[model samples]
Every structure is written in C-alpha cells, then in structure tokens.
Target chain A: MSDALPGPTLSDEPILRVEDLKVHFPITKGIVIQRKVATVKAVDGVSFTIRRGETLGLVGESGSGKSTTGLAVLRMLTPTAGRIVFEGQDIAPHRGAELLAVRRRMQMVYQDPYGSLNPRMTIRSIVGEPLAVHGLDGDKKATREKVAALIASVGLLPDMADRYPHEFSGGQRQRIGIARSLALEPSLLIADEPVSALDVSIQAQVINLFMDLQERLGLTYLFIAHDLAVVRHISTRIAVMYLGRIVEIADRDDLYRNPLHPYTEALMAAVPVADPEVEARRPRAVISGEVPSALRPPPGCSFHTRCPRAMAVCKTEQPFLRKISPERAVACHLHTS
Target chain B: MTRPLLEVNNLTTRFRTERGTVAAVDGVSFQVAPGETLAIVGESGSGKSVTALSVLRLIPNPPGRIESGEILFDGVNLVKLDDPGIRAVRGNKIAMIFQEPMSSLNPALTVGLQVAEPINVHRGTPWAKAYEAATELIGRVRIADAASRLNSYPHQYSGGMRQRVMIAMALACAPRLIIADEPTTALDVTVQAQILDLLKEVTRETGSSLILITHDLGVVARYADRVAVMYGGRIVEVAPARDLYARPQHPYTLGLMASVPRLDGGGGRRLMPIEGQPPDLASLPPGCSFGPRCRSIIPQCRTERPELIQVADRHAKACFANV
Candidate 1:
C-alpha cells in the first residue's frame, strides 16, 4: 500500500495554486511577417489557490477573463506568464508526454453541452474513450461495466448508454458530459459555465449534482461563471474578475455580505433578486458604463473607469492584491490606504 | 375602470411544420393598462415570444400564422386590420424592440437615418425636422453626443449602445405600446441594469405601456408591475408582481421560484428543483401542461386542462391542485 504512493505527500498542500497568471492574446497585422499591434490581456496577474475538495468560483462578465483563466490553468491556452502548480508540481512548462500524464489528473467540463458531445458516438463510447485512450481498457466487459457505473453516478440510467447525444434533453446531455469528464477520475475539475445553457428549472438539478459529486468523490473544482447567485450556491470561496484582473477574492458568505471592491459591490447590486421585497429594499446603485476592452484596459486600476468610488490615486497608480483578512484579498485603493 | 391599452383575448398562434401544426401560443389571454408594465415570463418553447410577435402581426405567413384571436388596441381589433392599416399602426402606435439589436438594425444605414425613417413614414415629417426629432430620441435614451453619433454605423457602436439605438427607434414615433422581447439579455449584468432602468424611465416619461417578454425571474420581479407565467403555450398563472413573488399560486410558479437561486438567499440552502424535462410543444400532454412536473398534482390535472380563474384580486391560477 505504501509503494502505491511514493512522494512527499502533505495533507495541507493545496490541490491547485495559480500565481500571477497572465494570458495575453496578441493582435497582429499583415498575413506575412505579422507584427504585433496590441495585446489583449485576457487574464492578467491573477492568483488563487484551491484546497483539496474545495470549489473556487471565478466570476465575471464578458471580456473579464474568467474563461481565459480556466483555459490557462488546463493548459488548453498557453499562458503568457505565470505558474500553474497542480498538486505541488508546476506543470506550466510541461508538454507532450509530461503534460499528458499531468492532464490525466485534471479535466475540464465545457459550457455548451450540445456542442461538446460527439454526435456520431454513443453515450457509452463517449464516456469510455478516455479510459481506452489511457490504456485502461483491459477487456470488453470491464470497460462496459465502468461506463455503466459512470453513467449511473450522474443519475442517468445505465441503459441510456446505447443512445446518441441528440436523443437526450439539454439537462440530460449536460449530465452525460459530466459523466464523461468523471471517467478519468480526475482530482480537479474546471467547470466553465456548465449549467448556463440549460433551462432555468433544470439548472438547479445540475448544480445539485455537482455538489453531490464533489462530496462523494472528494474532488476540487474551479467553477467559472458570470452569474453571482449560481456561483454563491456552490463555491467555498470566490474570486471576482474585472477587465482581466482579479479585483477581489474572499470566502463565499463574507464576500456577498461585505464586498470590499467597488466592482464586486456593483456586480452584486446589479443582480436583481427574485424576491420583490428584497428588490424594493435594496439600493439602486447600478454602476454606469460598459466594460473597457482588454486590448486597452484603463490605466492604473482596470476598474477605475467604472468604479463608483474612484479616487485620483485609482486612476494613476495600480492597486495590488493585498490580504486584508485571513480569508480575504482585495485590490482597491480605498481599502489599501 | 379605464379600458386596457392593449387587450389580447384567447390568442392562438400556430406554426405549420413537417410533423404537424403545432400551437405555439394556445388560447393565451392578458391585458396591459396605460403606462403599466406587464412581463410575460417563460422558458424556451413556452410561447412567450410567439405571443409578442402575434400581437404585432410579425409572424411569417407561410409557416406561421395567428389562427384565432382578438388583439384590441384602443378599441380597434388589430387582428382584423388590413395590410396598410396594420402598417400604419406599426411604428406609429405600436413598436417592437427585438432581442438582437445587431440583426435588427441595418449596417448600411446611419443611426440618425434609421431612427428618423419611422417619423418620415408615419407622420411624413421633413427630413430636417425628422433628423432633429431623432437626435432628441437618441438623447432621451441616454446616448451622449446624440447628434454626432447619428452618422455612426451599427458596427461602430458597442452592444449596449446598439441596444440603446434600438430603443430610440422604437420610441421615435412615441408609440402608445412598446413590446421589448428580452432587450437586455445580450448585455452584461451592470449594462443590463442600466438598459432596463433607461427603458423604465423613458416609458414612464412617455406614458407608454410596455410588454416585457423574458425568462429571467429576477428581471421580472424588479421591473414588472404585473407578471403572467406561461408554460407549454398557455398562461398558467397571472398576478401582480408583489403578490406573485409573495405567494405563487400555481404549482409551476411555485416550483420555478424555488428552483432559482436568489442573490439574497444566503448560502447552503438546498434548491428544490422541479423534476422532469420542459414540455415538448410538438407533442404536449393530454391535460395540464405542468401535470407531469407538478409536486401537488391532483387527479383532475391529468384528466382535464384547467383554465385560469381569479382566486384573488388581480391574481389568477390555472391549476386544480391546492398549492
């Protein structure tokens, strides 16, 4: 049993740690000898950590780099600069066989269930492909049993494995996607807006399924979404991004109750509560203006342009992500000074 | 009481498909008083958007048509109007703001020209006067430097700005009724708040009745004076916004409210999601549309469809269960 696990294994070590991660997409001109005109800093200097079995939600609107950060962590998109340490190993520079071995422990669940599944393959084949690809397909009967168990884990019937993707509903398709991602038995899952495409009534079912899977499997998650309410439901801690930079990161309940950054406050206030009484009692402090382009983000603090409480310093000097409390970090001049 | 600004009675809209004639909006009825905001809330294939298109007669004739209904606007039945009569009403008395602003506006034309064209056609105003009016309309929707932006194309403007231009065109003639179908769904949350606030403000100033069709329960709670919950092409429940949120009568409404995770609902609360898939409009069930999904389903619900009946003042529900 001890031979199966040979390394300096620490119980308190984070399952994943991302430090100063930057994913800049270059805009070039000309077809031949293209010259870089500008750089879109999609994920700039973002940092966070996820303990084993904890869900860290990354939330932001369009062009905020929430999706880019998730991709960079998975190495699907190369990071311009940073460290993505998974289980104490910096796999940022790994490639080919090294990267493939590391990727076996990390999986990503996409946002669009309709486009993610293969139309030509059956549900059993789609879920079992990963097992076969990793040389785990020992025999026909064993592989079929494994696929059936995975399908049943997501609350879908085992017999549905023979059906195609199009035959199932949107919610059922999303469950199948989850089942396929879990086939590898990865320790960390990066779910990017996994339930946004489903119907309102079905979104809750998927969310509950995610929580259930996490508890039963002891899986860590990096949940990226734009909806604050949905993020709050499943996250242990949250990181709020704006203009490709993380403006605030705190515990789930603390962040919602007392948001330090102006952008965080504005984002929360903008989400209309379902209860009319709560809506009436809440303040109408909707921040004006749209998100600035990532190619030319506002100088100093990226959110200063739309910050309701922006001061002179916020426009000229950048704010660093500094720890204010044990479980909170904020990038705002108002709190720094 | 004063007559409703727009009254739709038993409006049934169907589309001819390869499978069969599918009733997209089945016997739906609702009303909107002057200056009031009525939000029709439903998910995809619930017929909320079809009802809005039916009101304006924008449904394509070959594949889609209004089978039977009475759309009365200021005492005149719009469903019975001739082609030219309907054209006169459109943009002059009732204007529609579509969900996608990029597709709705022409890229070849300037913002000023598009906004002013309705004024030119409806009232036959001179080009100079119409341009001036268009500038005012754009400014009313909170677009800065409206005169300067008139020459800008739709491609030059951002998504939020493009939507503002769509709203300006809808208000060019000061239409009595404005039907906006998910106007802010494409924009971000903060931008969505700004757009909805501007819409409410401009409509209030003009005293125009607004029919907002959307699937977001949160948006409906904040902006709607009255709400009509739709399911499987029928109006399952109707009530004042406050009452509906306070006490949702229908089982579907109750399930929907419970399913959504609220911003203020703290953390760790388990969501009670309604079981079963959304109804298939092509092959709907025999009786109640929500019977299979209802938590408190009664025997009568599976045998016969229920009609919306007034259970309280301004509150109605179409369910046989005592929920």
Candidate 2:
C-alpha cells in the first residue's frame, strides 16, 4: 500500500529554512544578587528545512532540543542566534505586528492535551480563538459555524463545540487541538508530540487524521516526537537530534535502513519490536550511561560520552553536519571525512 | 513445567465516582510463572495499571476497591491478607515500579536513602548496611558511579537515571515478583530498551517473575514470555508472545497490532487505525466494552458479555466470533 505513494523528493525552494538556531535559558543562583551560574542550552546551532507539503519528523530522546528547535522556528522563544526564513522571507527579524502576521501562516499543536486547552473556554472559543485573534470573521455565528465544520473535519462531532475540554477524552481533545490548529488554514503546522499523550490505538487515528488533513489542505508539518515507530509512520524525512543539535538527517527509509551516526544507530536499536521473531533476530546496540545534562553539554559531540564507537577525535573535535550521501546528512566524525 | 509464581483469577476492581461504581478491572485473569515476563498490553483506562495496583492493595480506598477475585502469590491469597500481611509482601515479596520515576521517587530524599528505605522497611537492616546494598543495586541496574549518584536527589537524576533508581529500589529486597507499570513510557526509545534489557537480565538472574504493564506491543514482543491484551477493564486475549502477535484471536488485539507502526513497514502509508475511541469507563455499554470499536463485532457481542474461553493450550480469548 505504501509503495503506491511517491517517495519524498527534496524541493529547490523550502517553505521554512532554519540555520544555526540557538536557544539558551539563563540559570541563576544565590539569594543576595542572583548571579548567573550557567546556561541551559536547549537548542544550539541546529539547522534544518521544511518544504511545502512535506512532513519532517524531528526525533530524539528527552532534552534533545527537538521541541526547543520547533519553538525557535515559530519564534515562540527568541533565538539567541539563527536565521528562520519562511516562504523566502526572513521572519526571525520581525517583531510585534510583523511577527504576528507571519504567525498567521504557521501554526503549532502542543504536546499536552490536559494542559494546553483552557478549562474556561468551550470548544467553540478554543478553536475559534485564532480566528478571533486574527479578526478574520466579524460575526460570531459565522465563526461558530466555521469552528463546527473544522471540528467535524477532524472526525469530531459538530455538537461538541459547546462542551469543555474536560468533557472530552484524551484522543478527542487532541482532535479538537488539531481542529484548532487547522482553523486558520495555515500552510505550516508544527505538531510537538501531538499524539504522544494519546493511546496507541488512538495515536494511529490522530496520525492518519494529520495525513488526511495534509492531503486535503496541502499543509506541511514539523512533527516532533521521541518515538521512532511513530515518526516512521508519518514522516517523509527524519532529523535525529541529541542534546541541543541535529546529529543526522535523511529520508525516512535511508535513516532507518542505513543510519550512519552512532546516536541514530543507538536510537534505532532501542526501538522495541512487536513481532517476537523480528525482535529476536535484531541485534540490539544498547548504549551505556545516561544522557548528560543539557546545562553542561559535553565538550564536543554531546553524545560522545554515551557513544559506543566514541574515539579521541569525538571528545575534542565537534563534527560538522556534512552530506554523506546525496540525501543523507550526518554530524559524526566517522562521516565527516 | 514449573508452577506459576503469581496467579490472578477472575480479578475485578471497581472505583466509586460521583457518576457510579465503574468496574475498572472486570474478571481479568492471568498468571506469571517464576522467572517469566508477563505483559499486560492496553491503552489508558484499559485497567492494566489498576490490575497491577490491586495485587499490592495500592488502589485508593473509599473511591476504589477490589470487589472480587483472588491474587495468589506463592500459594498465598494476597487478597485475603491483612494490612500488615500485605505490607510485608509489598516490598519484600512483591515490588513495583511506577510509570513516572520523577513522581514515584521521593523528591526530598537522596537516591540512596529512597532505594535503601525499601530494604530497611522490609528487612529492618541497619541504615548503613541498607545504603550499601542500595548502591550495589544501583550498579546492578547500570547506573554509573553508583557511590556518587547515591547522594543525589531525585530531581538531580535524569529521567532515565531516575527510572534506573526506581528499578534499583524495587529490586532492593530481591522480591519474588516485580510489577512495573509503564516504567519506560516516560523514557526515550534508547533508554527504554536499556531499561527493558536491565529488567530482563536482573529478573533472569534472580529468578523473579515480572509483570510488565504497558501499552506498547513492541515491548511485549521483545521481553514478555506471555502477553495479555486488555481493553475496557477486561482481558480480551492472553497467549504466548509469539502466538498472540502472529495470530491474535481477539478482534481488539488484532486492531491494536495493526495500528502500531512497524519499523520494517514501508513509509508514507496510513496506519490501519482502530475506527472509534476506547469505551468510557463511567458509562460502559451493556455487552462487550470493545463492541463499539471492533470491526468483527456481531449482534451477539453487543448483547452478551463473552466469557474468556480457552482457544488453544494455555491460550484464552474473550471473544465468541474470533475463537
């Protein structure tokens, strides 16, 4: 069934292009003056691009800067340094009203359904907030009708517009969130672990909904998640991140079939298989030690300390993101040469 | 064949809410043999966690109660045991690892103290001796620099490391059975695999039975000897790991299997998602809880609750049509 779909081809012009993105939160200590102790480098020197109608899956362990990168792209958090060119325009330099205008074309669906949705707001207000904020429609009746239609489009009942978030189940709430993201008819959608909070059975539903929406609306996606299985299901291209930087990026099949980066290999090895025979046959490369603190990321490759194939060069020389194959890019010293 | 270490027979747990008493675990039955891993696979509200919590009598009283069933551990009925008896068995004979290690471990206490507390509480060993044993257990779980890490608080440890600490604490007393409830849900794939491997290796070394409560079918195939598919508070299907995945008898089980995206599966294809949502526990339907979502559901399934009947040797499914 999957073979019928065309392979994801790279476009000459990307809808969103990010270069050397960095987001650092200041850390302070002591009571007297609150001196700066250090910085938590959530995202550092990460570069990627999302073409129109393309789904780019950003995968990594927790604190891998995937979510931070997403936020930085959306300009939710002011980046310390980077370029975010959306639709051939540098949107990073924009501020206030200018940034708001750019945001109309880009939308984000958050991770937590329980927390993201406002308890005070009904489904009508929650989904219509974007429309209200943008002042798209004047009449409340017209907005409510549009919201209802959007809800129905996402497989939710139109009558649910009157209900609160608490009344809906986790999966239903996520659909509502998706509907809210789609309310503005944005070209780019950044879904940060959109289906992570959902059940396995329901996750597939949400994922398929996203695909269906993409096909129908011609929307692009920056899908962020830690689950490789899920990323494999929805994404065309995948970018592997580790502690503040993208370690590898490639076509979904290329990355899964022949992952070059050590971290990528380790991540793939860690995914549990549902088939007993397949699991038994696969040789697992269990990386030793825990992911180091993002506050004090390793001196060189952030994953060097935990990398099974770590060498002296890995500790001193921070590898640059270089194209290993035409479609595959990796940042390990082994592939740098 | 060896006798099973833990046997759960017709276990049914209920929770009294403002709406009504909802049966969270309805007549669920499964057994875990010594040194074997039994996985309970289900989505949220499927009662997989509740079933595990019932074994330890950890279900919140007043609101939640085990209405009926027998939890037989080492030939002793845990359900019948008094507070002290259950307490005695909780950490010493049966240990548990919660879903979120960050919340499960004490934020105030150091990792060493938290892990050692189990040993001290159950065995009454000296604090110093218990602390030493805790450090050893930490090392056993593959937490590097165990001595230095022991002094660190739960907040100081990473998610994966904290989970390792939780595992260490659970194994502190060398319990006969360990009930891990979604222990790897909060962890990354790499960390989750490491934790699973550690669990499997530790359990194998100690000859302890493991009840891994999780929704991930992949984890079950990798580590579990037996798999029990739960839905709407009932065991819809239970079979050997390989057999269940290859030929799932229950429609719900098959749906779950098909829904999960395989690593080897081709790209760009939409996953075969289960049509509808999981049933609401508060207002469950008359017959089968999964009838609304089941593709193969019949009129009989909607009208009558199916009994878990043996479909094969040591394999049972709670479905009329599939069997």
Candidate with best DockQ = 1
lDDT of each: 0.91, 0.88
lDDT of 1 by residue, B195-285 (tens): 9999999899999999999989999999999999999999999999999999999989998998898877867788889898999888888
Q: Model 1, stretches more than 4 Å misplaced?
A: A1-11
Error of 1 at B159 (Å): 0.6
| Candidate maximizing lDDT | 1
Q: Is the docking of candidate 2 incorrect, acceptable, medium or high quality?
A: medium
> Candidate 1 chain B: worst 10 consecutive residues by lDDT?
B261-270
Error of 1 at A174 (Å): 0.7
Please report how far candidate 2 places residue A175 from its true position, in Å: 1.4
TM for chain B in all models?
0.99, 0.97
Local lDDT at B23 for model 1: 98
DockQ of predictions, in order shown: 0.83, 0.79
Single-chain TM-score of chain A, each candidate:
0.96, 0.94
Q: Fill in the DockQ of model 2.
A: 0.79
